[model samples]
Target: MSDRMRMMVVMCAVALLAGCAGGLGGGTYERAEARRAMTVDYGTVESVRQVQLEGTKTPVGTIAGAAVGGVAGSTIGGGSGRTIATVLGAVAGGVAGSAVEESATRKRGVEVTVKLDNGQLLAVVQEDEGEGFSPGERVRVVRDGRTTRVSR
Candidate 1:
């Protein structure tokens, strides 16, 4: 492919990878979660702390990047020079792609500690979106299997 075509492919790949990132906010729910039964408990927010949620590190991004890079690099030179360029491009692309994926998937979150009406203390971490939580505020702790979230 031409250099321009290769560049377009790379851009499209990056866009696709970015679009694949899903939100973890309390307001966001997986399709499988719909119609599922969940448990709810009342509690008072004891504390709220801002936190950073790490992003996913899947091979899809790295592979896609390497492929795009190799294609782009192949257009650089001839013979051994071209081979070297391809390898370097693939390596650089892989690293950049991983970083991009991580940055794209990362989210702002909060660690909320709540005191249940029964005196049980619990802490839940979830993406910080929609209703914000504050100390001494009444909230609901919703649980679906291993997943838990705090909301008003």
Candidate 2:
């Protein structure tokens, strides 16, 4: 074969080999499902508490607002007036920053309850899902010291 034809054949062989190696780990994940005989229970929310979530201090809106307000305020006056303008601009920027932060930090409450199989209930408010239990669902309750894990 010519030099050009020989190079083309080699490249084609390499490409075919790469393609064959690409699909080696393509398979389905299988989990064994089995039923265990245990007690199933229910609960109710006794009280709800408002919580403030921990989040990033720097939100896009706060940064954008500060930038725009600073530019606008700094341009509003000349000389000493410009100094006053910048200070005022910083105050406005702070207010805008806080508003943005508060909105971002707003938290949602998850209701946690302890239920006995004999229809008793106790509720608590927590940021994390307590025992991974949802409303009106059957779960396997594993009890440890001051904590629980609800499994299906």
Clashes of each: 0, 0
Deviation of model 1 at 120, angstroms: 1.2
lDDT tens digits, residue span 67-86, model 1: 78788788899999999999
After superposing candidate 2 on the true structure, give the runs of residues whose Cα lies further than 4 Å from its correct spot.
1-68, 116-136, 139-152
Q: What is candidate 2's CA lDDT for residue 117?
A: 65
Clash tally for model 1? 0
Alpha carbon lDDT of each predicted model = 0.85, 0.47
Specify the poorest-scoring 10-residue window by lDDT in model 2: 21-30
Task: Find the 10 residues in a row with the least total lDDT in model 1.
Answer: 18-27
Over 49-127, each residue of candidate 2 has an lDDT whose tens digit, in order, gives 4444443344444544454455556767798998788677766865675465555544444445556566666554444
Q: What residue runs in model 1 are displaced by over 4 Å at the alpha carbon?
A: none
Alpha-carbon RMSD, candidate 1: 1.5
